[model samples]
Target: MLKDVFVVAATSFVALPALAQTCAFTMECYETEACQDTSFALTAELDDSKLVTDFGDLTVVGVKRDAPLITVFATGEGAEYLLSRNGDTARFTAHSNDGPTAITYLGTCEGEF
Candidate 1:
């Protein structure tokens, strides 16, 4: 009976789904040198739980732009990011499993080029 109970508990725990949260965010990339003017936009659906849950300092990994380096802030999942660009429009990848996908919390901006 104890073994059976343990097995049932384990099964139930495995059946539990991962926590999910969602939000909409956008980041615009600027020029490589001056970075004064706007160049492109990157938008993503972020999972709130996985991101910087605490309002602490967001750790920025790296940034790239225009097939090279650009000044921009990104905060979201580490999963495969599907990027779609048209002229100057930006869009994010849509997941079929869940909505409001997890996101890494990118910080805000207050500086000029």
Candidate 2:
């Protein structure tokens, strides 16, 4: 019984990390200040959207304090920059090229059928 219990506990420990898994994404970006020819992949999620982008020895517009980090992006004209959060959505905008890009936190989403 003790051996079976230990096996179950080990399985739970192994499976918990998988259950808390997050999604990954890739994006290509290029601007005057920075340019990235190669695409990089980073983890992301629909909720509390976290992304990681890193171009090794590639031309890019900015610097990171850490080796990898996530940034926001937009599509089309007037399209709000989107971030995910457990079924909630947040939008951000590029305030300037000087900083890590300004992200205006849009509140959580509500109302559902």
Per-model TM-score versus the true fold: 0.21, 0.28
Tens-digit lDDT track of model 2 for 33-103:
34333322323322323333242211123222222233334332223343333443322233444543443
The residue pairs in collision within model 1 are 22-100, 46-101, 47-101, 47-102, 47-103, 76-104
lDDT of 2 at 20: 21
Looking at model 2, report the run of 10 residues with the lowest lDDT sum: 55-64
Candidate 1 matches the true fold with a TM-score of 0.21
Model 1 accuracy (lDDT, Cα): 0.33
Superposed Cα RMSD, model 2: 12.5
For candidate 1, the 10 contiguous residues with the lowest summed lDDT are: 104-113
Residues 1-113 of candidate 1: C-alpha lDDT, one tens digit per residue = 99999999888867544432222234432222221222222222222212232233233343335632133333434433333333333333322224434322222322111
